[model samples]
Target: MNAIEKLQSERQRVVARLAEIDRILGQYEELQRIAESYLASGASHTADSGTVTDSVKTQAEAQREPSVTEPNLPRVKSPKTPMVEFERVVIELLSEAEVPLDRSALYKALLDREIVIGSPDESSDLNTLSARMSRMKDKVVNVSGHGYWPKDRAFLPGGYVPTGVDDMPSQDATSESGLV
Candidate 1:
């Protein structure tokens, strides 16, 4: 072959090698992109798992610890004595009465005993006495429909009296009579 033809053949071979190199570089770029995407996806998945584990651990810890407050917890008031002096006076008045005294009667009894002598404030209304009676009904004494009664009437000095005439005698009376 002549020199020009040989030179032409060598140039064609060089051009083909350059095209192969370009194709290999393109493939390498594609592989590098896929690897980067996979790494990012793996990192995101790990982060999500870590967050879920941390949340579950926090919830478990909260449930395991004791609470500071509980519902319907009974609270004892401070300076806890059996009964106040005013409450005792009221009980004394009820123990002496033959019939069930209403709230007004109880108030009058209090005034007679000089326990609640006079109004303390300018409002000076009967509502204050009514409120006190309500508090006594709920807290200090046991009250029936009509009036207030002492809780431990059996222990009182005068003893208990039946409110109604038709009411039967107590178990003590029946046992004493040998009805059983």
Candidate 2:
């Protein structure tokens, strides 16, 4: 083919690829907008058309706590112990307990003492508690099957026997690293 014709064909291909890239970029931008809207409103959204579903709360509504007369309102955040206070409470609870408490039992105790605030949705509270506890390696040890134990005490809670059945890697391992 002639040199000019070949150059034109290459230019056309480049233009077509650029157009395709622009179309893909537009799709990503739309998806990002949809995600931001969903997060801001705490509302469910359909990706295909970016339509709202009826399940979740609006941003304004979520921020405002509903009255008792309005029982069907979306869940709201409850008053919670500040993180520093929460750490103290956990230490106190684990130290005083006669038996090691599993995650669920620990959650119940926190709710009972009002050390950790309760919410309308209990499962979310449990999840939050679990996440917080997972970070507390220096303060507590989650001995498998036995439950949480204060790290400083260096003793298992009463009524828990070492059966050699699901021990941590080693006592020395835990003590040396300051994490069990």
Candidate 3:
């Protein structure tokens, strides 16, 4: 095809794609409205039934026009706890913990304090937290499978010492012996 014709064709395709996107956005908005109405209509009633009614299902299906289906599209969710706040809460939890806190315990603590505002999936949330902790090497220390400890050793519970730490000589001993 000639350059002019090809350019026109591309333009037409872009316009068509934009229109499709607009339609999909509208459908999502309608779905959100329906969900909001359902919530406002006392979702407890639905929960008591323990099964979705056919009418509600059909109504939703009818509202959605058949189109290109991309089942893996990412969902836009509520904002997560800010990085600074997350780090602060984690430090607080670790410092208060008597011993190293395992991932499950830390996750539970975070949830209890409402600091974990990330994914609803437990594994994903754990992974995210693990990654964050890994990056906080200067602020926290991981005791292998035992869990996390505050980098500030003083924050550790009284008489609690991480494994392998006892094997190392103290700075005082090394300095006194002129090992520095």
Top candidate on TM-score is 3
**lDDT tens digits by residue: candidate 3, 44-130:** 422424322221333244335343323333343333666677788899998777668888899899878856447778889998988
Model 2 / residue 48 / CA error / Å:
35
Candidate 2 lDDT, tens digit per residue, 7-86? 77666655545444454454554445456545655677445442223323444443353222222322222335556667
- On lDDT, the leading prediction is 3
The digit string of per-residue lDDT tens for model 1 on 16-50 reads 44444444454454345334545644433223343
User: Model 3 has how many clashing residue pairs?
Assistant: 0
Candidate 2's TM-score: 0.43
What is candidate 1's local distance difference test score? 0.46
What TM-scores do the predictions have?
0.32, 0.43, 0.44
> What overall lDDT, based on C-alpha atoms, would model 3 receive against the true structure?
0.60
The residue-level lDDT of candidate 3 at 4 comes to 92
Ranking by lDDT: 3, 2, 1
Model 3 lDDT, residue 134, Cα: 86
Off by more than 4 A, model 1: 1-83, 117-125, 138-145, 152-180
Backbone collision count in every prediction?
A: 0, 0, 0
